[model samples]
Target: MKKKHMARGTGALVLVTGLAISAIGNPAHAALSGQALVNSKCATCHEAKTDQHWTRIGESRRTPEGWDMTVARMTFAHGVKLSSEERGAVVKYLADTYGLAPDETADHRYIIERTPSVVEHPESKPIGDTCARCHSYGRIAVQRRTEDDWRKLVHFHVGQFPAIEIQAGGRDRNWFEIATGDVAKELGKVYGYDTASWKQWQAQKHADASGVWRLVGNRPGVGAYEGKATIARTGDDRYSVAMVMRYENGSEESAKGSAIVYTGHEWRATLKQGGRDIHQVFSLGANGAELNGRWFEANNDAVGGTMRAVRADKGVPASVLSVQPAMVRAGMRTTLAINGVGLNGEVNLGRGVKVIKLVEQSAERIVAEVEVAKDVASSSRDVQVGRASGAGLLKLYKQIDYVKVLPQHPMARVGGNGGSQPKVPAQLEAIAWAAGPDGKPGTADDIRLGAVPAAWSVDNLNKMAAEMQDTKFAGRIEQTGLFVPNGAGPNAERKYKTNNAGELKVTATVKDGSRMVKASAPLIVTVQRFNDPPIR
Candidate 1:
């Protein structure tokens, strides 16, 4: 979603005050209760009954961030106006009363957590084709709203993407009508804001999230890093943070940022690191002892990593934070170092992995030379130091059952020098995963054995793709999965005089035992990115 920037000016405030007076008969403004404030400000345009329930207001719940966006939209798009204090009270009231149910967010955590290489399928076919066609379903499912708001959102879409009405399913029937009518109502019913869960959560005491924390994070292309963060409360549920990190290669960096914690558990931060903006979306653990989330480059959502933070003073148990060269090839001997806290005593590197020699030992780290058996089956195993165990922290794999294409669904822009814009290529990586004992594709037992050598190829996803001559015009995928798109603009060499865009499929095949296992993901050859935000 595009970020909304609030307009600032005395003129805008004056305009808002005049609108407020016209909407609600009251000219005097005072510190009103949340309900009273909503009744006076929002209920003027939105219908409100005697029970204090506003038509659209009573039907939905949202995070503080979501409510903030909504209020901004109302002021900018609908001409709703209120003082800063009034806006805060309204947002707080709405978020507190109408926030997300834990159950509602359970299935869609992958988006919030930004787990890498994840492929999500929509729950309904209509939603998949209509809503998820342009973006992820998580973006849609994450918010709650009333039928009116849902309808308004549909209108907003039609206004923004005028061609949507004539595209694919949109042209199949009364798409706009259905989307603004039954579909909107259905969405409101399923993802409505009011729920018993919100009430329960609102009544519970929230943990204070202020203090020093130890952080461990992994960026896909950059490897792993360790850091420390010091946070100080700035306002109610808001904080300022400073952090420093050290990469595996001894490179160091630092950042300063601020964060807002919505619903007391959702922590979102914007930090300036290495002169670039970064967005961190994390969930404060129930106990408030840990923070688990993802941090990404604000302009490119794909360039991010899994992040975890633990309270520095909580006296955490001995745990392995990371292992150098996380994965090793079968039959190869390598020196491995396990880094973490309270590391001592003899370390066990799991079965099929034998320690060749102890290279180093300390209270916070352990290094040893290890060897892996060539015939060992691929799987993640536990690494132990006395009684403290890191389960599934180490892997000893001999073969890969399937390969995953990173950024599973990627868009490659056609290259050109006309606008002095070099074509943006998609850097793809094929990660190998070892099938579990069951030899199944989807199961908890499946283990990511890490990046491995694989043969790469591109093809058409369907008959229409083939008819479009995607194989001939879309571009090509190298043996390493790096996709370089065709030149931009209309091509006289092709049947259709249009930009060489097409729907393509990327496949990675690997040799596993006596069989060849392969995996495929979708790709789109398209135009260049114009406004590249840090997170998309």
Candidate 2:
């Protein structure tokens, strides 16, 4: 990972990221393994142990990016010089030796995925208002540390970011004491270094990642895609990958790259597709039965899709991966696109639905048209094709009562214009909500109809925004629900020569029959963010 600096700000003052992974141990830095290099170089400040471990280095564990940030911080703050090759080796070494268990990172995958416009609600308000204000709750939860180490981290934060005492809610009380005494204690209990999952993971045998994988996922704003990935072992813990994917419109794209498998399960691949750099962060499932993760643009984390893949050979079981839309209205005719591995035989959709037309059927995909009974009860429906079955793959609903916008509150940044910083855009989607059995909207029983087509537009958020004509200057929302922010830099034509910044409302208008269902989300368009660490 390259060095990225957290700018000088109230939140960035805390040393969360902007760390550079440097060379470890030997001065010549040649002909040495990653561990030996780390053991040699890190001992300068951190005391080396008899068992080839360092003081604080072995006291905590994190993901690859977390280790990258820690080492990068050493390079940035402590002036450690690290080469890209050395950084990769050391990161691989440390991540494999001291990495979080898959179970530990289950709830915090969003941070690893670098998802955008997420509103995190930390279980503890103090942690949310204090530490999370600087980064994300997932960034904190992704690491496991001992109680003593946690306490020491609090002290380090106070020493580095003295403004922590005055930043937002930090000024209200004794922040240091609360952080060291209570917060650290809570974090230790929740994110303890010694966990059974980690122990089991370390002891368990690792599966090889060389095989043909059937991939199925949806590219946001685009459509559904089904593909195949061929992985071949190239070296120790590394493989060469090739993927060919076909979208719903019959268009195809292929990507080829080299991948590194970390901690047995974490699969990281850097590839080129359609003349653009891309990356895949997927986890190889048990016995290499399945691979799950996402692929995103190298420069933009928000532009990506959810990926689920199953092994295509080596006696992999027949599986029904997914059923598109998932939900259908009663008394309606729907076309279902089924994606899976080795799909064949009978097509079964639980009660009140029957296949009327078989558009296409193959070993990997099956397209069928089905008719839904009008009197069918609203309930969960299973989908099965031959030996493969997916539970609760379909939901029977009566009507769509309303529409809603995801990421109810979002933030966009202006950037680019013969500059380095790229503009950050908003990927918005409109969802149709069905009033479930209770027939009342906004209840727990409401069902989601996924992404629906909508006319996108932006308006001033409030009186001040209206007076400033914020919508006119901020950016434009495309018809496909994509909000592209304006370029960075000050506009001399604007009042006070301010940059293109505004508080706007993103509105999605969906035409359902004669009724026009509409929904709105607040969007804040601001100046460029200079500090963008992977974990943020």
Best-performing candidate as measured by TM-score: 2
- TM-score for each predicted model, relative to the true structure: 0.71, 0.91
| Clashes by residue pair, model 1 | 61-98, 61-193, 298-534, 298-535, 299-533, 299-534, 299-535, 300-534
Best lDDT among the predictions, by candidate number: 2
Encode model 1's per-residue lDDT on 8-93: one tens digit a residue: 11111111121222121112333345556767778878887543467767666665545655675677677777766566556655
- Local distance difference test, per candidate? 0.68, 0.77
Supply candidate 1's per-residue lDDT for 61: 64
Model 2 Cα RMSD, Å?
5.9
